[model samples]
Target: MEMEKTTDPTSFHGAYRMTPATFDELLALVGPHIVKQTTNFRDPVGVSERLGITLRYLATDMSQRDVARHFCVGRATVCKIIQEVCQAIWEVGAPLFMAKPTTEDWKKIAEEFNNQWNFPHCLGAVDGKHIHIQKPALSGSLYFNYKRTFSTILMGVADAAYRFIYLDVGSYGREHDGSVFAQSTFGKALEDGTLLLPQSPNGDLPYVFVGDEAFPLKPQLMRPYPGKNLSDKKKIFNYRLSRARRVVENAFGIMVSKWRILRQPIIAKPEKVDKIVKAIGVLHNFMREKEGLEVECDVGSESGMTDVQIRLGANMYSGAAWDIRENFANHFSSPQGSLPYQNDIVQRGLNI
Candidate 1:
């Protein structure tokens, strides 16, 4: 009698096609050392297969069970693989992406802020974005935000080039932007003066950051003038500040777009949520460095604003008009020899 043939249960349906170049590129960003290898006796799937499968899931928004089925592994195995990948990315790639700006880097950023958005002595643009995560099995309300949804806060500081200089994640979803900032390490840095403020090139001005109305009005933080029928100059200043402040929004968009895992409601435990966010951030920076992708800036199209508006907008936003007008009587008057107002002007120029 002829023997019947049995199909291999572990055989993958789709052709396994990944080039060394692709693997090398991924490894360069994520680091080869952190990537786990399969061994004998404890025979497991190939490292490439595991990483590729997990990344495919992240990139495609596939369910973990679906990924497991595609890879011919158990659902638990898929989760393990994802955990490993995330941990690897954090450990090996986090440093490569998140770098504190050096003095020269700060100068370059400041100059760009001055030239582009008319904010000066501004080191970085700061913002908070809500990243939706799966409700934790144990503490669901802890992650609920004002939006009445579960999400973790992603606060970031980006330079003129739109690269993240600092990132903090895993704040409770219910917390407001101010609350998150007040409790964060970066906030502490600011409060304690550990995070150095940019020095004015002229030695008489202080540094400042541009923030939305959501942030408090302070010497270091600026908000747009809240009124209609304002003078052309104040309007121009608002426009310029808005333009510079857009960098943080763009950064958030790029991040969520690249890591589709973040796009999905994260289902991981609350304690591990920080790891997931850090991993995504590390990957973002890694891709930037290893892939040499140009950092995109969204300075509104030239067609949108007239040449006069652009020039005036740039100047007004930079506080040049404020610098010139010291009559303190006219609508455009600024306090004479006032360091705070001067710093505000420089800050407006830098577009923080």
Candidate 2:
């Protein structure tokens, strides 16, 4: 005989795949928005239950069918609940967690970069991730990536601490990182100087985002020198810049680790999967703040110097952007800003 459905929250939370405290905290945050009007003794599945249902699916990579079986709801009901609760979570969580900070906040981030990563005048790090998903019907090769898998792009900016500052998700995976970034609104904002970035401490420097070679170099952006034939100063500069970019790498790792749904190929339509990915991003910040949860990605933080980021060769800009990069590179090798190891590396003539 089949066993009766358990109603105990302690047991439910174990199945929910997060701590009881975190589950309760999440329910309290978004329960009002997702709460259903029709609930009684026979229909005990309320807002909190549906919230738990959705969170369980996210945390465990469980299918909607499995979630429905566990939650004692129909598959259609489960699907509706997931979308509804996800929307609620984004509405309640985005402004608080994903919203851009003030100039003062940016200053703190730059200060952290100076203290921790030894990269000064840095604002944030940018990177792109491919969210794997099943191919949609009648949509031939639209989502096929170079890796021969289907996915959507999740391009994001993270600060020194791996907190997401901006995100643009749901782009077709066929587009390369450079093109995706070029088309992103954040990239446009950076180019247009519409973002209120924190001013340099001494006012002579421009605050900038650190990215891999996948991104084009700009006055407000920094990328390492191309080619294996590099100098010690170039090596040191590359290392310093890579170290700063680790925050975004770690953030993605922690996110995928915690929300295992992203680990496997998500099975859903692109429209629904978009909502799921976005909700995951928002909830990542929520769970991170509430639980102080940060687990590094199993593969470790990537330097992005690999072949994937090395494409879209050699772009020349007709302006001072190139000059600014030269200035930073020169300053990195100068006595005023050069680190001891940097000098040692230069002295040893080692290429990093």
Candidate 3:
């Protein structure tokens, strides 16, 4: 309470990662569910306080005990409050922030990819990252990843605006992106052709999601051509695809940069961590949408450009998928579809 009274607006945002107005808006939405009944025994914690505690925990690496101290509450109470409030936030915010896109929505996303990323007919960018966690009890190697960390995988699809179109959490970290994606509900829908996507006019080329070498190349999914000795046209296609696909990477970057809880290893069970991760993802979309955030990709070392490679045999990608990729590659180098700066970027990549 003293801190609240004394802290300036910048300090408040640094603490909670949102403006007072935004906090009030969020409190109004999730307040009812988290509000406690005033019993004769004692008055319960206020809704604003409950939400504030949770936000501070997420925005920083503070432990529940530390958060409890900061909020003048018991550690056990802080734990319960964080869990309950996170669940309430997800329940209230997920539908609005993470709603599955319709055909029209997909079309708009593709249009944005074309306009902003210069990658036409691109629906979204897909990738997965390992989220570190404590090793679960009696679980041998289930959560252990190649990075030798006990973690879970967070697979996401981000549109050109860097908003997550879909998120799948809680996959075992031992699994790679491709395997996790292949097993995901969203991936299954895409494979089954049941996922809502905008129809192509000619019916020859379908809208595609740009991924990296870690993912399989499909008619619906486009990946960079594997190998160093690529032609200028293929290099241009790669540069364009990487430009678009980097949105997901930057989305993750912004999310982790803003919500520092994800940067440290979460000390919780896998089930609890799943809720926390989902809550964070939902909150990420909410903040990005409400804030009108910019999508900025890193201009760092080109070495950071390529994603983790898991060897996918050439035979795994169908001929039709190859043809689609070729078409995109050719178009990216053509006068009608080429960008003025694409060649320069491709050359820089090659020199690097």
Q: Which is the leading candidate under lDDT? A: 3
Ranking by TM-score: 3, 2, 1
**Candidate 1 — worst ten consecutive residues by lDDT sum?**
303-312
Q: What is the number of backbone collisions in each predicted candidate, taken in the order shown?
A: 12, 0, 0
Residue 265, candidate 3: C-alpha displacement in angstroms: 0.3
Candidate 1: where is the Cα deviation over 4 Å? 1-23, 28-32, 35-40, 203-205, 292-352
lDDT of each: 0.59, 0.76, 0.83
Lowest lDDT 10-residue stretch of candidate 3: 297-306
Clash pairs, model 3 backbone: none
Q: List model 3 lDDT by residue over 203-313, tens digit each.
A: 445799988888988999999987888888988888888889888988887788778888778888998888888898898899987875633322221211123326456
For model 2, give the 10-residue run with minimal summed lDDT.
301-310
Task: Give the RMSD in angstroms, all C-alphas superposed, for model 1.
Answer: 10.3
Per-candidate TM-scores read: 0.73, 0.88, 0.92
Between candidates 1 and 3, the one scoring higher on lDDT is: 3
Candidate 2, clashing residue pairs?
A: none
Q: What is the lDDT of residue 146 in candidate 2?
A: 80
